[model samples]
Target: MSDCILEMRGITKEFPGVKALNNVHLRVKAGEIHALCGENGAGKSTLMKVLSGVYPHGTYTGDILYQGNVCRFKNIKQSEEAGIVIIHQELALVPQLSIAENLFLGNEQAQKGVIDWRKTKLETLELMKKVGLAEPADTLVSQIGVGKQQLVEIAKALAKKVRLLILDEPTAALNEDDSENLLNLLLELKKQGITSIMISHKLNEITKIADSITVLRDGQTIETLDVQGGELTENRIIKGMVGRELQNRYPERHAEIGEVIFEVKEWNVHHPLRPDRKVVSDANLSVRKGEIAGIAGLMGSGRTELAMSIFGKSYGKNISGTLIKDGRQLNIRHAGDAIQNGIVYVTEDRKGNGLILMDNIKGNITLSKLNKVASGLVMDERREKHEAERFRRKLNIKTPDIYQTTGNLSGGNQQKVMLSKWIFAEPDILILDEPTRGIDVGAKYEIYGIINQLAEEGKAVIIISSELPELLGMCDRIYTMCEGELTAEFSKEDASQETLMKYMTNRIKKGGEAYADTGANG
Candidate 1:
């Protein structure tokens, strides 16, 4: 195209034991949002790194043509200087710093070795406004929500005068409104002549904002399509990514509902920091003896908070709940107390809260229930190894041995370890939040199989998912929360994307009342 702004031709990248990228070709027109689509480990990140100069010219074989001339980027700094900025999937803001400070961290507004505080704040406010952030620049990053933090990231990129912005899963953690806002911001940026490259698993989002789409699979470029004139659909994009038509994004599971085993009534959770604020309001939910109940919502809709608060109040303050297991109410005020009562929650944040990353699989699995293998103060190391080995096989965790550190494993394998840890606790009620997020399709299938098996085993499984397909496919019943309230309840037969999203955004009414759901269920 005559409007081509950036191009990579014959790009090849290799690791010692793997070919990360294979002659991948990509072209982007000026002021167009180019979506990079791929499954995890499909060389998308590797290609971006190479383009952004994380891999220097000597390390990768490629020719980058920006604005028609050939160029080689030596480092991230050089790339930024050339008006290319990348915001990583994991946000890069200093939590303790003010928004202004983070926006101009290394590139401070200084004159004669003196920082210009007034000018910095003024510029930060303008930049934040450009990205649709309404907050004051002096606000600390930690004080704001994740969606706002994402805006700050954009503002930082804008501060660098980025013409080509690369976003890796920018809206993965965003709620419906926030995600919409981010997409609208991208559209606005496009109008301002800023070209964007977005890499995401949310195909619907890609369809809405991207002007063109490129598919990368198994370290190779498949095809690129112009998304204008309704040329791109989710099914087509998925076919390109997975290399085959996925009959359904959500794998089907036949449900065999049984008697109710786990029940919560009138549960209430207060904000962890601001005790006066309710995070989860009065809510009532139940999971059957052999059924999967799904809690669906946008980010910050109290889905994860509900799971965490109910799990020994591990996440929220001023928590009060009546947990009824087998028609008997039990007090579960601590993590150990919940575990003893046959309840376990596998957190969404596996790397941070779920696993002892530096430790081996055996150590992490047994760490949850050391009392089972403990003789007095010391655990019987032999028995622990035997138990870990048993689950490693049962769960199909692809580790060389139970002794290998968990951090070295893939995201999917690490998730398996987290599950193994909870399963060892022998819980009757198991809560899984974002269980299959950021994993490959094959891994997602394995995780789904495990969930199905758990349901078959008569565990009361409560699955909280960002992906609607997962909830629709695996859940016997679905509960959708918006803001801080449960707005809709649907039997699996009645649920659809539209209905679920209606509740998820607080658009639907439940029990003749419209309310923002604070996840209070007992």
Candidate 2:
């Protein structure tokens, strides 16, 4: 028998109206990276929560064995005491505190009554060095980037003497370089005999790092794949995730480019807090009727800032832009004006700004277009439900019903509700910023189909994405932005990963000509 560090046998967990996990079995060997994969609502996180004692003892039916000893932990503290630590998808770090403080937050270095600041700082430095973070221990967590913050999280785990670490979507928010560094760090940890269980939606990352993959579908374990034996592909994983073969990752689209419908000329936006700093430079972009346009750039390249500034004056201060719609220049000062003028923006931060998590799906979907379901300033509850039901069906939003809370829905379904909220508002031009940020592959294809349907309906769609492949696959024309400026534009036939990266990194100086590689015609 293999030296299994952890084994969860016949685990079954249930919520009030949902069966999250059903007799799920997972076995992880010592010092190996075990990957757990599933669709958005496929019980991956729930299982991890149960294992880490977030559900506690007697709440779920299961037997958890760690190193051949059956363990029943009552709380997170108990689990941590047993050398099990879970770093959640949403980071749990106090932004106001220093790295040393966050590293020893719950478990502080103290003697009887007071904390030993000197010892805490010294230990934090050691942990930081172990994680390859070169920052000072006194540095505030907010001062560091997302990549550095992730390292701090791991350091915190190490502080607890974690033997089996569970990471939920660790690289979901990281850029390519940061993600690579984090993955390499995980390998180093494995060499030091630390076991890891990773839950991820990024199939490519899983294929590259995972020694063994355990797939789940609808709260049931599908199969455990030994990737070390070879012949494990993303397509095979997708089949196990969705329970069906996905013929293509991106849906087929027939483009019908028409005359220019919307255009932005000499658009400039200053930073919200620091008016002296310009976030978006004098940029020009346009979209035609029935066209799918894409904005491609590295993170912090002013792509999201540009979209928000155009949607309303929602992002920056001292905005100067000429918005042309159907040969008419319109001044949009607020969100209401933008919506009334047939322009809607689907925000990238769906959990933060897009939807009301506390409210039900019916409420969120009808929020943007409440007037449609209102009678003389009074909401028609029946009409609202009818309208919400229509969108739920149209978008294929999976839930028990439209009455389910938006927060409880999976990432893909929550995104669908966000789209429904905007689409119901009846916008001619839709600006989608990172629409499919943290969703599964099966859901991505569904969203692409929705985009295609919108294009077929002659709506102008602009997608801003960090994924180069997504932009290339979905857009008819792609624009590359770098350092707050538009660097290059390419049609579908002309764009590729390499060509887009060239423009994305090749920055143009202030008041300087375009790069020499991209000629006057380009």
Structural RMSD, model 2: 1.9
Could you list the CA RMSD of all candidates, in the order they appear?
3.9, 1.9
lDDT of 1: 0.86
Question: Residue 43: error of model 2 in Å?
Answer: 0.7
For model 1, how does the per-residue alpha-carbon lDDT over 67-178 read when each residue is reduced to its tens digit? 8878799999989999989999889899999999999999899999999999999999899889988887888999999899999999999999999999988987776778
| TM-score winner | 2
**TM-score per candidate, in order?**
0.87, 0.97
Give every collision pair in model 2: none
User: Top lDDT: which candidate number?
Assistant: 2
